[model samples]
Target: QLGRCRSVKEFEKLNRIGEGTYGIVYRARDTLTDETVALKKVRMDNEKDGMPISSLREITLLLQLRHPNIVELKEVVVGNHLESIFLVMGYCEQDLASLLENMQTPFSEAQVKCIILQVLKGLQYLHENYVIHRDLKVSNLLMTDKGCVKIADFGLARTYGMPPKPMTPKVVTLWYRAPELLLGMTTQTTSIDMWAMGCILAELQPHKPLLPGTSEIHQIDLIVQLLGTPNENIWPGFSKLPLVSQYTLRKQPY
Candidate 1:
């Protein structure tokens, strides 16, 4: 069980890191520990409603996950105002998305490999525990000053059974979505993350998004363009997908 929620007054806020789907994160100094930490202010505006489901899911999952490559959720803290809650997490210098945008120079091949390797390791642990990070993107991957990469954000993550249950295909972002997901496959697996990883790896090389499609249909078109049109020979049961009929797929070959 979670310990008594500490007051946010114990920490000194430095600057805002960034806003996530569920809350706004800030860099802070933990007075008691004298250590830097990320304080994510949980967005709970509705007083009538206790806590948001997304925040609850993230807190529950993060509390259970323990891995070097995964961001550590130190504890839950609160502010003086009602509904002002915060999540104390391990501090990281920068996220991969920010680095990609602001860096003067692009990452070297070895550097990219190092980052991706750590991400894969983190992802490996998650998969081993039957957890799926439904939303895997560059912004969610953070790096410390020591070059250590940690996977953050678990709002869309959920553990799966031996035979996975049906998941919403709308979970992942359009650009990094897997082909199967684009074809309206509600069932998901670790392979969906691997597909995003492939996109991330390619993006690292080019220093830009690999598949920045405007919409879902456009995203599929781009994927087909890069990898060629999929067929039964390439992807078994591709023709039977629910959304396949919506597209006039080109006869492009790999």
Candidate 2:
């Protein structure tokens, strides 16, 4: 079990911090200890009724994870007026995405290494626990006051191997996504996360996303253009996917 945290009513909601796909985050302070925390306002009504599956998965997994590299999911609360669900999470000053965007110069080699290493450490833990961070965009990587990486937002995250043959091929965010996922490859592995790690590392060099593909087809075009097309010899059974022929052939040999 993880360490203990106070109840929901203990914190005072400060202001809306940011907004994302699943929810909105707010800055809050613990009325008891005066410590700050981030509160995530998740939309539950959109998913029919009751708690959304995404929030459910996040709560179940985060309650079990006791790691410094991962964000602390403190509590789950229901809004008083609207019944919207909110997740009480550890406070982070900023995210890697905003930092990268606001940077005047590219991250130094050592800085990039440090950032990627922390991310790897977090991913290593999650992957070891059979968890896949389906959405690992830069915005999801939060930085603490001491410059540590906390893997947050398990809304799209899931624990695989629950089923031997996982049927899901479409996961993960676009820019930092792995080639295996982008190509609609079967099987999920730590390698998929590593591919994203490579892209994250590459992004730090220029302060720009390495593969900023807008959509799956354009993403594939960028991939084939940058890394060249994957053939059956390289990525065996490449032609078997339902979406393999979604785009016109890029002339793999070109």
Candidate 3:
């Protein structure tokens, strides 16, 4: 597939847009077509292995996914060196995180609803296709000048099947992480993404993170403080999780 890919030299980097755990994104213009696009240079500086597993998975999954609300991966382009790989993606004007930080006022209720609706539609398509966006946060969502919302960043995403396999509970950002993940649940499902959606929804109205926990323990305490403690009556398997015994429960009645 790399042999068929166009060279990264074909795209002119306009400016650096953002950086994440996996890669650095650049706003670029395709010289061949004179079209604007986002060039995501895969970070392989520390990897002794050929290509990072996360990048491989992202490339594979993005190639198969096609939805209006999902960021489009146009193609994979190689740089001058073999290890210098870049993903050509559909360009968006801005991300939600930066937008929220720069805006003088919070989003209107109708605008928030529209953004959430678009994200939900994208997530529904992903879930239907058996893919779980393990990292679902405001920064991962982008918006075009025309007000179209698209979900980006698939480095932590995974495809699941019947008899779900165990995955790491340490995936999502701490602020938007689910309670099940915080309690050390290994078997992740679509519910984790939904939990994050709720957080995003709440954040949109206030123009700030809903649960800005400093650490895992603080995060759990915040959840307990907001919703009260969970018990056997509220959560059937509450006591069975691996790390449940590690933390003492605050007897604040739910």
Query: Quick one: best lDDT, which candidate?
Result: 3
lDDT of 1: 0.90
Q: Which of 2 and 3 is the better model by TM-score?
A: 3
lDDT of 3 by residue, 1-254 (tens): 88898999999999999986599999999999999999999999788888999999999999999999999999999998779999999999999999999999889999999999999999999999999999999999999999999999999999998888999999999999999999999999999999999999999989988899999999999889888999889999999988899999687769
Q: Write the per-residue lDDT of candidate 2 for residues 7-110, one digit (tens) a residue.
A: 45666888888975578889998797788989888776556566677767778999888788899987776544335566778899999999989988888899
Q: What's the ranking of the predictions by TM-score, best on top?
A: 3, 1, 2
The lowest-lDDT stretch of 10 consecutive residues in candidate 1 is 43-52
The 10 consecutive residues of candidate 2 with the worst lDDT sum are: 1-10
Pairs of residues clashing in candidate 3: none
lDDT (0 to 1) per candidate? 0.90, 0.78, 0.95
Steric collisions counted per model: 0, 0, 0
Flag regions of model 1 displaced more than 4 Å: 1-3, 45-47
Candidate 2 regions with alpha-carbon error over 4 angstroms: 1-9, 185-187, 252-254
Q: Which of the predicted structures, 1 or 3, would earn the higher TM-score when compared with the native?
A: 3
**TM-scores of the candidates in the order shown:** 0.95, 0.89, 0.98
After superposing candidate 3, which stretches have Cα over 4 Å from the reference? none
Clashing pairs for predicted structure model 1, backbone only: none
